[model samples]
Target chain A: MTGGLVYLLYVLFAVGGIALYLAMPRTQGAHAKAGLVIGGGAVAGLLALCAQVYMAPHGSNIFYYIFAGVALLAAGRVVTHPNPTYSAVYFALVVLSVAVLLVMQRAEFLAVALVIIYAGAILVTYAFVIMLAQQSGGGSSADQRAREPMLAIIASFVVMGTIAGRVSDLRELPNSPVEVQATADVMDVPLADTPVKDAGNTLSVGRTMFNQYVVVVQLAGLLLLVAMVGAIAVSRKRIPADEHGPPPPPPGEIGRTVPPF
Target chain B: MLLAFTQLGFSSILALVILGIILGMVAYSIYFERKIAGWVQDRYGPNRVGLPTLVGDLLPEKYGKFHFWGLGQPIADGLKFFLKEDIIPSHVDKPLFLIAPCVSLIVALIGFVVIPWGGQVAIFGQVFNVQVANPDIGLLYILGVGSMGVYGVVLGGWASNNKYSVYGAVRATAQMLSYEIPMGVAIMCVVLTCGQVRLEEIMASQVAGWNVWNLFYHPVAFIILWITMFAETNRTPFDLAECEQELVGGFHTEYSAMKFAMFFLAEYAHMITGCAFLAVLFCGGWDPIPFVRIPLFRPEDTGIIAMLAKMAVLFGKVAFFMFMYMWVRWTVPRFRFDQLMRVAWKGLIPASLGVLAVAIAGLYLGLHRTLWFTLPGNVAVVLVSLWVMSRAKDPVSGREANLPPLTRSPELGVQA
Candidate 1:
């Protein structure tokens, strides 16, 4: 009964947040928009609190709450921010917050990898593109305006509900023999023999990736190669004239009467 | 609550000390850079500024004339920056413009946290390691934070609402993206050989042993790393981002006063961090010298005096690298934008990749235990790659045909 009440409250808060987002004015008064965003954030935070209270008996520690809050806040800002450049910057913050969470989970390799790959390379490139292509007058008209806001809000809420339902359903299922055996196999690996003392986690991760999922790794590498080639081909500029076109007259002769020769 | 207070107090004290030392080093590094530049140009650098007026008045006339070889220049410069007018252009993105320099300086400062400076020292019956944080992924943390430095440059350029600044930011983004690949690969060679990502462990592995320093075994990787460091730090010949001839002041064009000073400080701080990283990775952090076994200078030598000496050694190496940076800045001509990209993508990337391949092959052939096989293998890889590179068509040269010829010849002055 408590879980049902919590779920109902979560739905109500989510809907109210979406309504506030949609009701925000398009122009002239940024304060109203900011107020709406704050309202949405408060509702989202309450929903998260409700979900956490309902799902976990132990309740997450302070660090988990802090990182999760930062991640969610930044992620929200990334989508709602009007300026594309600020959006990209907020995306980096999201990546950083997520990296902190991953570190908390003892997945240091993944955390560092996310920072290096997403925040470092990918988001930097995104910022470059946004800055380079930014239109005059702060931004393009489309940037200041949201399209089909009502539809977008509803669709996003539906997706969120579906994911929440799926997660709750998975939580109720009993552990099967195959799942237990798979976990046991993972636990059986001897991580102590790695050369580096403090790098056993990374070593074990690498071992599992290469030994148990070698084929998947190879496929990923192959996919990256294909993507690289495709990107080059797609972006390569075509020469204005045919390669075998008639040779132009000599430079000095081009503008002179002797060009006929 | 008491326990938390103690932990927090200890950390806060340590952080304050480290911050103070780093700031002092950064200030002196600017002075050091100017001195090197002056020597390179055959001129006497700032040698006039000294004590404040009050202190000068208190001293005897002769003593006041000393000036201590202009040691007070950086302090004076800092004061000047503070006294200057802080300008915020009306057209600028106000918030981002204000935050950019702070971001740059903060990111630069954070990269030093994982650097094990003095190794270990005994004090009052307790052993203490002189590092802010000794995470297992120390090297990765440095790389991660180091990469974020580009963001500050990009944002500063974008927020300035100037074309030149945007161009500068674009060039920085491109340069960083290109150089990072080879840099990562070079670091991989070190990590593969040491089998450790921890900076302290890497340092420990190199002390008083055959293949003592990573520089000997990974000579090619070291060269690649050195070149990438120049690119990474935006030093010549790769400082296309802020090239005075093209981009004016680059990303910080519109910045003034303390904000501009922050960008300047950030650059020096980054150089210090990069030099320290190189010292730690290849030169053996806190090790007196490669393959030289001083009686009291082993990794296990945890005496306070020994730790001090180790710190001095690391500092000396970092200073040498910093000096090398300034020397190269005045020595090498800046690369053209296209040429810079070619050097990174065509030259350094393939060279580093070849070295990585050779290292992996050596490891596979059971050469991981010693530098005996790996050193030769690396040398062979470098030579082979160089030969292959020379045989390939020069991409930069071929592209020059598309450029317009000079309209007015120097001898002719101007066409009639």
Candidate 2:
């Protein structure tokens, strides 16, 4: 990547940061309209820059463009939306479009699993919490205003810039035809034309997971189990008297049952 | 007997045809729900709404007056819905409110595409499948789409800006999340037993050479799936979200006109899709008999007549399942909210997990398809679950362990 292109990328991120800071919901001074327009422009500029740099190496499909655009747009809405419920809903849209993008890359099982877990389960829980919270206390000042917007935006943009720099560096790797074809096979080919290719994809994923990554999978499951146990322990109710260290039950009364209501 | 259309064209045409059939079925299912309610309560339903006046005039008076068992009532009901005033309440979130019903209807409609209505049809010497699309992850696709149904109800409830509506949405979210676990586990049982994730392959496994339907081998899983299906569709026994006595029409309380009708249509559409999916999974889809595969209706039989016969058989199974839905709705009373949660978390989830375990064991034993291994395994799981439930120590109605200890009220002379 050229020094000029890197500078241009930084400029775009700076513009996006400004737009996002301006767009963050507030109780007064509605600059949302201006912020949204500026943010959209910044995003489009970023996309164009990326397309110019990478479209030659990665032969573009129209669906790749459409779904990726929608994912980015919805992700922006997820952050900028005033209402928490709407934010969660926009997040679901992001999940869906990203899932479609995954499917285009022939990760059908992973794509559907993403929809089921993230869009279906996690986002619904988020929406539920937002709805319950809003009912209890309708739109607090905390929800209405962004906290330390400039610092947060700068921090995130710095991380994104670093990743972008690294990605650009990847383009200079030994561009062997075999590696190029492998990359194209893994990333560029849409599975819709030959769905038969997908039949083996799931099987291969399962085989690889259980064969090579079996320990990793089991450890992940164990981590989840530990988290669940911790959650249950934290959420369990304790009587006020118990905080003062109540005496143990008498020997004869040990394991005594509580009467049903 | 076919045209000059390409295979893709024919599939597209079949997709349209299936859509039309499903819409028609949805319209009539509502009528049948009412008719079944009437029958259960010992009264006639929609008998007054015969053919339209224009159509009646073209027929003889006696025949027109016969009412044709209220066959035209759905059409009349549909027309009324169209003519009615569409109301958007002032307090609601307009965008989400508008999108909710559409989401509901689209999610409901899209689930049927993977359901192989008939095995295959030979058209103009070309073999075309009688399905919209048969993705490799067909069953999971259906599950994913079914999970998406939560969005419509949640959005509708939230956007209604009513307390009852919010309550309904919260309940729906919890119920769907809870039931989906057992539902997925039950499906996993089927996938394990058949060693196939594709709906057509699953069906083909059942249809191959005197093989029995999955219902016989995994009866416990079938029962679990049946119960979870009701919860997933928000039908009675599990319709806590919109139970009229408590939530006052629940999520659709604020909906009216075409929007309300869309929600109504989506419910019936969900029923049809769920039933079709259940048939494809547990019953030998498009195979007329379980143990005995008739030569004419075997899945391999790809003639036009065979395809039509297979389609009729599949539709018949779907209709039977739909009827069971209505019958159960009328027969069983709705569970209390806490009881509903208890049933899912304590009862169905464990049972489904056990069923999945049995399926895994059956697979390992190389008797997944055999009646002896699976049937007895199902029976043992059911018996064990029942025994465990009987030995349970907690209160039956609610989560008492989490509640604070009751205090005595001196004035009321009771624990509060």
Candidate 3:
């Protein structure tokens, strides 16, 4: 990446980290309004910079900008909102925005699947848990306080910067014939915007998944099955305290119990 | 207006027309629901609310005296909702409370965009679909939108700051989550049988063959979908969420005026959409007759008159389902919450899975569309499920055995 762009990225990340730290709820108080303004500006600036550098080749799409903005803003809310229920709702908004962005890329199957699995199913379960668990109006003290905000912000930003730097450097590479051949060799089919036809992207995706990546898909299903089994095993364990005692130990102290199974 | 509509395409025009039609249907469904309830209970419903006196005076005596079978009631009710005091409870989440009804109504309304209401139509030498958007994943689109409908209930209940509202919302969340599995599996059965995800293609499959509907192939799935539809729409006997005897007014208890009206409109809209989905998936979407395609009702007949006739047929099926909704609402008593859960988990889910398995096996054997293969398979599934239910040892309607036994109590002499 160029020195100027690198410097801008640094500035943006620094401002955003500070904004998130300020916005995160604390025991005393939080400057949420100020944090929101600063964070929004930082995010917008970062998006603009990315657009200028990466998306300059493709003409600017209004929908792309709008949905991306919404995704980023709602993602911010999901992290920084004090109310867990509202956080879950904001996460749904983020899923919706991302789904729209996927649609803009002509990944219609992925877009609808994302909406179905994330916004429709997972977020509903999240809202269910948050609503039932959070009896208070605003939020619990755990939700009202950020744990090690500085360390998390720094670690996440560092990783993000590294990835962004690597992507930009790769994008800056010369489009040599050898490089194109390598890309074709790796992908089998060259990456291009194939105009969607009668069967649409769904057929293409399903064919590729089942034909080429069948093993990977089966492995993913196996992983999910293992996770399900693990969850069932964990939940089936009957701790003595849970059945007969007054009340199970509070949340943090639950590690004290040993699983009989 | 004509020029604008031409520029926007027929799909946009159809969308506007469908929106108007659905809103009107939603209004009248409320009237019909009350009328049906009244009929079931041997009492008069809203027959007295005729035309307003001001409008009545302006008309001729003959026309003014006409009651129009209480057709003016929905209009009056709409006006009442508009003029009624819009009350937002003080101790509530203001933003969420305001957004919930709109979310509910919008999600309910948008699901119809993918339903092929009248198949293809020929207009001004151009062939166009009656549906607003014919996405490849049309069935999945409907399922996704229907799944999103639960958010409104949960949000409204949470925002109401009432215990009953919370209970109602919790029940709604759990119920929707439970019933969606069976509904999705049932739809998958249709998809496997047809080998298509597009609603129009699926409709064409039933129309092009022996002209038999998917319901004939998978009656068990149809029955499962029918039961889940009531649960998904939070209707009786699955409407444990808003059972008046327990939770007063349920999730919308604290809502007043237009907000309450919006929730009511959403429920009716959801019913209409669910009915349309059922018609599209199992019944021939726009075919008037299932086993026999009449002359003008064939899929190939794309004339304007034919299109209108097909639309009427689709609406007829939808209306029948809507009537059934009201019929079941008044006839069948509400299930207890535990019973509702039992019906979904033990009854619908297992039965739907069986139907899905039969579909897959039929597809594998290249007899997915044949009556000989699918019909017997569906019947067998029903018989097996019945046998299993008969053999089950546990009572269906009682406290769950999974719950921890009562703790030891010295005074009460109860043991763990």
* Candidate 3 ranges beyond 4 A from true positions: A1-3, A55-58, A137-140, A169-197, A233-261, B1-8, B52-66, B397-416
In every candidate, how many clashes are there? 0, 0, 0
RMSD of each: 5.3, 6.3, 7.5
Compared with the true structure, what per-residue lDDT tens digits does model 2 show for residues A1-261?
Answer: 787898889888889888888887877896888888898888888878878777754437777667777787778778777788889989999999999977876678889999999999988989989998886346457776777777888898889888887687677653333343345456544323433333354655565466556899999999999999999999997565345444333322222334433
> Whose TM-score is higher: candidate 1's or candidate 2's?
2
For candidate 1, write residues A51-109 as lDDT tens digits. Answer: 56544432556666676677766666666677788889889988998998788766777
Task: For each candidate, report its DockQ versus the true two-chain complex.
Answer: 0.35, 0.30, 0.28
lDDT of 2: 0.84
- Check candidate 3 and list the clashing pairs: none
Candidate 1 per-residue lDDT over residues B1-416, each given as its tens digit: 33443323444656787678778988998887888888899998887887666454566887646777788899999999999999999999999999899999999888888888877766656566767777768999999998999988999999999999999999999999999999999999998888888887887777746527888878899989988999888888999989899899888899999999999899888888898899989988887767778755676677878877977888888889988998999898999999898888888888898889877887787676477887888878878877988798763543334333334444544454
Model 1 ranges with Cα > 4 A deviation: A16-20, A23-60, A138-140, A168-199, A238-261, B1-12, B53-64, B395-399, B403-416
Poorest stretch of ten by lDDT in candidate 2 chain A: A248-257
After TM-score superposition, the amount by which residue B257's alpha carbon in candidate 2 deviates from its true location, in angstroms, is 0.4
Runs of candidate 2 with Cα error greater than 4 angstroms are A1-6, A56-60, A136-139, A169-199, A238-261, B1-7, B53-64, B398-416
Could you tell me the TM-score of candidate 1? 0.88
Which interface RMSD does candidate 2 score? 8.7
Q: TM for chain B in all models?
A: 0.91, 0.93, 0.92
